[model samples]
Target: WVINIVRFYKVYCDVEPKRQALSKANADLAVAQDKLVNIKAKIAHLNENLVKLTAKFETATSDKLKCQQAAEATASTISLANRLVGGLVSENVRWAEAVRDFKQQKSALCGDVLLITAFVSYLGYFTKKYRQDL
Candidate 1:
């Protein structure tokens, strides 16, 4: 009976360690399963955000292309306007100089006409001897 008791005690000691190891393995497996569930949920959320961002990026790229085209057209128009205005400015300066010359010539012509008219009228009325005496 004592030998039988010793044998039973030895078997109990070995079985106890195996049971504890199995319990620990089961707990670790449960924790790992929970973490896996959380990771899958996070991946799903990230994929949705990526889809939305991709759509927004495509819209922004199209808008950028349109804006660049508009800018180029505006720049060309501004260049044309500058060239036209430059030519007109030079023409305006030349026109102003011509007008000033015309004004001066008109004033000189008026004085010349008055002098000729006076000489003709006085010379015709007086004789050669009276003109020489005066």
Candidate 2:
């Protein structure tokens, strides 16, 4: 009975440490499960934000494309206006040069007529003087 009691006590001591180790492992498992739950919640929240950000990014891209199209249209309109203005300026310059050339020709013709008339008058006076002297 004495030997049996000592063996029993030794067995009990070994079982106690096993039980404590099991309990510690169980506690660690519970803490790990809690951490996993929190991490899952964070992942869910991050997924929701990612969805929202994707939608916002699409909207921004659409708006940017529309703005670029509008800018291109404006640039085309300005280019057309510039071309028209250039054509009009060129036409006006041509008209001004033509008018200047016409005025110069008219002045030259007038000068030629005046010289012819003076020469005719002098010729008539000299012919009358020659006839009277003869």
Candidate 3:
């Protein structure tokens, strides 16, 4: 009976260390599980942010495309307006020159009319040969 008691005491000593190791392993497992839960939550938050950023990027791209088209249209309009102005400016120069020519012709027309009337009256008293010479 005494030998059996000593053997049981030895077995109890061996099991004590194994029990302590088991407790430490359980504590480490709990900490690892908590860390895993926190990492998953962080991943979920990052995914949400990524979705929002992607939407904003798409909106900005569309806005940039619209603005580019508007700018192109405005440039086309300006080009057409410049061409129209160029045509009108050329026409203005032609009109001014024609007006100047008409004014000069008007000043000379009075003297020409007077000379024609005097010649017609003076030639009525002359023979055809003398009128032709005059």
In order, candidate lDDTs are: 0.93, 0.93, 0.94
lDDT string for model 2 (18-64, tens) is 99999999999999999999999999999999999999999999999
Residue 99 C-alpha lDDT in model 3? 97
lDDT of 3 by residue, 11-54 (tens): 98999899999999999999999999999999999999999999
Sorted on lDDT, best first, the list reads 3, 2, 1
Model 1 segments beyond 4 Å from truth? 1-9, 88-134
TM-scores, all candidates, are: 0.54, 0.60, 0.59
Question: What digit string (tens of lDDT, one per residue) describes model 1 on residues 1-134?
Answer: 99999998999898989989999989999999999999999999999999999999999999999999999999999999999999999999999999999998897998888998988788878998887876
Deviation (Å) of 132 in candidate 3 = 29
Instruction: Point out the worst 10-residue segment of candidate 2 by lDDT.
Output: 125-134
What clash pairs does model 1 have? none
Predicted structure 3: lDDT: 0.94
Model 3 bad stretches (over 4 Å): 1-11, 95-134
